[model samples]
Target: MGRHSPAPAPSAAASAAAAAAASSASTPPPRGGRAPRDADADSPSAAELRGLLEDGDGGAAPGGGRELSYLQAVNFAGGLLLPLRLPSAHAIHKRPSAAYLEAGTLLGEEAGRLLKLAGPLFIEGITNIGAQLVATTTVSRLGAGPLALSALVLAQTQLNFGYSIVCGIAAAMETCAGQAFGARHYALLGLILQCAMALCLLFAVPTAALWASGAMAPLLVRLGQLPDVAAAAGSLLQLMWPVLPLLVVSETTGQYLLAQGVAAPASVAGLTSLACAVPAYWWLVGRLGWLRGAPAAQVSLQAIAAVVVVAWRSARDARVARTEPHRATWRGWSFEALRGLPTYARYAVPAAAMLCAEWWIWEAVVFLAGLLPSRAEVQLGALGFVMQVSIATWTLSYSIGTGAATRIANALGAGHASNARRIFVLACCLLAVANSAVAATLWCLRHRLSAALTPDPEIGAEVRRILPAAILGVVGDGQVAVLGGLLRAAGRQSTGALIHFCTYWLFGLPAGVLLGFVFEWGALGLWMGVASATALQAVALHAWVALGLDWQREVRRSAATVGALLGSTGATPTPAAAPARSFAIAGLEEDGLTEEEEDGDEEGGGGGAGAGAGSALTSPAGAGGGSGLTSPLLGGRG
Candidate 1:
């Protein structure tokens, strides 16, 4: 291989001209004076990428293979389970030396952006989980015996699934919001979020009725829960009504803020409220009664914090709108926004299914573990303890995953397909790094951490016994958590959902039962089976994505998705040919040639919120993450 001189990088002007040239060549002009919607079918970036891959610049040892090898996936899995010692999927392995330099630079940029977003996400997850820990501990102290403790644990575990389901429904906003923000179609971001909020609230009515009214555990009772445990748990759940709607609100709103790369206030609010809830737990439960509305206040604060952050950002955005004419706010969108609900649901339903199905797989393990004969009681306790620890560590992965999806969406929206691909691999690297640390730490402190998670020495000992399985399981959990998000960004939510169903529901669960009950390995065996399934799931997903997924195609798909969403409700700008074909239409204002020209009326000011009255929003350094009624997400577990 003679090292002839490297190809010089194209300038900004040359890049734009190449893109315009490629767009013209790839797609034809629309008919009858219509605007072009698919003009960028083969964008300049995409065309260049195709050529690069052909020359074997696809990160496979420069001239080796174009795609990520099976070996890379194995290394990635190993890295996650084992940490820095193993290699993770990386673009550097695919490109030539000059390309390698560019790939490495992009990897760092993506990593930094990912950490920026994931940091708050982890904080939110911690605080949210911490709040639940506080509430659970308080309930366990009720002096109502081990039965009371058991009931609350069971009740919460069930509620966690419900919470995940609703948030799953809201996850649609991540894709819509991420793409819209990236393409600078700022108004669509607000509209998509509003639609998500409305949709989630509709789902929440039944959820609130069940959780707030204390009906969740009763549903479990009818399914075969012990009457006493069900009754006690239902009573605990009954006091949680105030948190239901707030949960959906905080989640949907946070999704909106994160897409715009704003995270600090919500993070601060969630972490602060959760931190406060710890002390509040002692005072509220000790004096105000058990399962009382005291902890709900923290949940409420978290929800309020989420709203406050959005509002704050909205207002700042509004002010910017007043000055920056390029920030195009759509005028008179109530009718359009209202009509888009069904359109939004089209995306949201599957998005929700993907997230919920995976989360419930964990819940299913708990339910099945209860079938064990004499050891069912302590076994459930041991399982729940380890599962929560795994879930808690998953916060980091979830945050990173969310950031990965958002950043991938943004790059794709901007028509940077190559960057999107680079970032995706980098995200996997980051995920492997984070999960490796989790595996290493859990492995190191099994004795101490296990004892700390429970009061009963026997249960603690059981936790230690199964700690290795939990450590291994989280390696996969963390991988899928991020991969799942990227899949959504790639317009493959259904595929991700299907993969998860097969992995956890069809395969993992069956393996667990076979190993646990049939093989008599008990809880440890069940966990080992599940852990194996997680690894398989991650490997399978990595393999499928590496071989089949195309970043350039995904970029085009994202554009079509947002364009179609906009057109469905007559929200597409007049003379939409350029927008339909061009990734960044170069112009959005009606009369002005550029975005800096202000609209005649202030009513059209804040473009990010669409036709709704402008809400204040701004980008700030975020401080944290959150999940369920007792979730460990945004403020505290709402």
Candidate 2:
């Protein structure tokens, strides 16, 4: 009766218009601006992210304020809201006390992750240093005079450059493998590992020729070395020819293993080989070309140990070897791997440059010390002693950064941008804390350091004079070194390389020359230059990461980078061959097995995370994209 009296029934068109108005009214507008486009809305602010995570469903109320189940929420909320950029610890703590507490706990998780990643690396690093120490001490026992010692240092510097090149190239495997695991591109991880090894073998040829022909020594002579010293250096380098390929193989295999998540074995291999180095040195010290053979044997032992461990570990894990028929990417040795060389060079070249720039700056300083008065041998020997000691301790902080990079890369590949930021923050904080403790310990021992390194009072005195500043420089470099790892993880190797070029090459080296020589400040002056460069570099990297790093963009870029390599390496399976994200190729599914299967394949085969287990192979990119990491200077820290 009321309806008949109110008015004639509304027309269909009027009813439709009224219904539209009611629907629009049901959903409120955002408090400020219009809703962002899909791409823009994909990465939301922290508060918006909180909304998406806090509810029982752990999802946002899309359509302004409507909650839905997880599946429907995607349509309602227009996909997950990810916080990409990690401003800094200061900014995160400044938000509120509650957030600060949460941030602190998150930071702890970050630290824990970094430790898990870096602990093996740290042990590996120490083992490596121990090997070097043993070799050097053995050489000293052979009664090489200061001239021979000087020659050895120069040879070591040149050989280190070659090592960097090979390690640099192998590092591409880290990026591709990590992303492949994350994107569920398991076959691609194997292909990348193989391709990288092939490239290293090829590159070693030219490196061998250069070392054998004495080309590396002329540069030392030009740098003001005595002619006799240069010749001795050339002889030492010539003896090291057998080691280049060995080093490349070891590094490539280890990197491959680590990306797959088998970290403990790599550490074990490193330690076992390190322990054997002394015996190798003793056995070979009396042989012809013994100067070269000792180190060759030592590194060869290490390389063989790493590769063998990976093989044995993979065999032990049944799930990892379920499908051995498809192990080879192309059935044999193929240069198709060479297709990825240029792409790798983009990352490796910069990384090599960065490490070389930092390393050579110091080496160059050592040579300049020769230009000083009549104490050239004493000064050069003293400088070498300091550098070796510094290297032994410097790796502590670098391991932290390396772990951070690995975790960040794995997170990005898994499409978790927040986890990546958490890793970045944790890395920075861990480096600060770790380096602080290391710096303090080193500083406290400054007086005894020189006496321990060299026997000569004059040389010891020179090292003593410079030890304080040199240790301090270690702290500063530690900060920059780890941040450099972050850039590598983010696939911004060029940025890190550029910073190194500017700070170490252009500014730091030149300043070191002017100060140490022209100003007569000596070794102390050189370290001061390094300190200055480290400060600038740390500031630059920190600013870039905190203010300019667009992690969402990096996520896309990383995916593209890894995808390009997978395609080039011929690892992508055909559409009809299997499901896109299926674990068929790595043998995750085989022989009528039920859905339940052992996790050996998922942990898979590799070095860094317990022979390749990080749950990295989670989901396919789904026509989407990610990045992973193998550090340029990180592993190839010559």
Candidate 3:
């Protein structure tokens, strides 16, 4: 996966052919001696030639000379002009019904589309979390000792921290692979999937080593944890070491399929795993009295998920090869996967930081609960219960967010800026409605839910006391999740990381500490502080999207991102022109010129025709014209 060499310059014959075609198309025939009607009929019109250029058709021209492919013409013209000279908003609106579609009709259509994608995702998220919930419950049934419960919490926290990194890498894949699939750049999807899997597996090495080394127990003890609890946590962590690689495979492969709009396999697999896990946990832990059973059952669940997803992938490939062979995504392993490492890291690092920032803040709050002056164990139990409820509710938002990101990425990749903007708007609306309903339902059932979760009156009472604040936090968290999706779709994870760091670390954590410790507000105050920060975070993200986002710019950036991946893998026939069609069709569709309008504009040598030609000649391969060359290929909005 060494750095790709630059695309070769066009051949002299191809260059001459392109020059001849451009001259023939642009220059007018002599007025004094018009060609006969028959001859005129045989010769291609200026509009026809333009169509050839736009469509990348491969055929002989008027003079029996070979015509350049669309990409070849782009490369011949120059590389930097194509992406910069996009159509204006007026032109975009000119497409039939593009601006005329009824708002209700559009919203209804988009809502259905979003729900289609989000449904399977929601099911998968719930089932995945359910498996973990079953493990936790089984562990609880072991006894009332704080040592086992505390150790399980500690071990699970550590596992989640590492797993979040894997998830971040998978999220990057959602951006890259989804856009590539949307852009009809099918070859790039396989390569991106491979890169994600490799990176995740590579990451698992050090994480697994740390878990297996038994260092966490001593570290936790030094950090003021009881020695017995830390030792039990360490042992549990060792038991969980093998699950890391399985998780990497499961998460990465599941995301790969999800990027392509194939979610049923993962959802079904999750359901099966959950069904198997509950019974396994009961048999191993409840009946057999094995402390290691909880971790063992978790490992089995992940293994099932990984295997099922891989099997589905293989079957999908076989089916695609037999039916739509040309559209097949996988092309076997290659060094090309290595070439994409830098690009993967460009998104993955910030995505990891963004998720870790939020996760660590919650973990910090949990630790804060442990530091209470009295009734620390009860407080910890209550906080844990509230956290689980919050996470379960968050699954709804996560599903919606993931669906939004997928749609936006696909729309931008296909050069549909208006559609992408619509998706963002619709996703926000859906998030609001869904979260509002969830908040109301939870508010009504807060007491019953708390009682169902635990038998301890003290823990149940504490949970009920904090439920209102946690519910508010869930609403804010839902908004933040969807906004984060917008950022991810646009490859703006670095910005997301900054937002999380500021909101969680600078504001949320500090506020929680001050209120929980200094003011002695306990768990309720800590949750209130987090809820306030979440609301602030959501507001900030909303303002950024409303004021700062440029959909047209994102469309161009998506082209570059996909183009860079295609170039790195050598999958595109003409690396230089890979991104050209992405925006070329966009410009054409946005301009909304009918055949007659095109002819009239060409005769006048102005308006839409001139703009289209100028756009092509000046901005080849979706590269922006003029000053756009100054922008880096992979650069995106911050």
The alpha-carbon deviation from the true structure for residue 69 of candidate 1, after best TM-score superposition, in angstroms, is 27
TM-score of each: 0.73, 0.73, 0.76
Model 2: lowest-lDDT 10 consecutive positions: 585-594
2 or 3: which has the higher TM-score?
3
Mark the regions of model 2 whose C-alpha exceeds 4 Å error after superposition: 1-110, 213-228, 287-299, 309-319, 323-336, 374-378, 454-457, 573-622, 625-638
> What lDDT would candidate 1 get against the real structure?
0.60
**172-274 in candidate 1: lDDT tens per residue?**
7777777665555666766777678788888777876776676666687898888888887777667665566777767777777666666655577676677
| Most accurate candidate by TM-score | 3
Q: lDDT score, residue 353, model 3?
A: 87
Using lDDT as the measure, what is the rank order of every candidate, best first?
A: 3, 1, 2
lDDT of 2 by residue, 1-638 (tens): 00111223333333443354456546666796342221222233455444433443223222111111121222223222122222222232122233334434534544554576677787888887787777666766663666655676667777777777787666555566665554445556656666677777787888888888878678667966789889887877787787787777667767765665556666777778887787777777756345666556655675667566657545533444465443322233456667767666666666666666666776667667777664677766677778777777777777777666666666555544545665576566667777788789888887777667777889889888777777777667677867876676666766777788898878887787788878888777777777788888888878877667666556556556655665566555422112212111101110111122112233322221211212222222224421122221121211
Candidate 1 vs candidate 3, lDDT winner: 3
Q: Candidate 2 — what's its lDDT?
A: 0.58
The stretch of ten residues in a row with the least summed lDDT in candidate 3 is: 602-611
Give the alpha-carbon lDDT of every model. Answer: 0.60, 0.58, 0.68
Candidate 3 lDDT tens digits, 26-70: 667679643222111122344533444443223433212212233
* Clash tally for model 2: 22
Number of the predicted model whose lDDT against the real structure is largest: 3
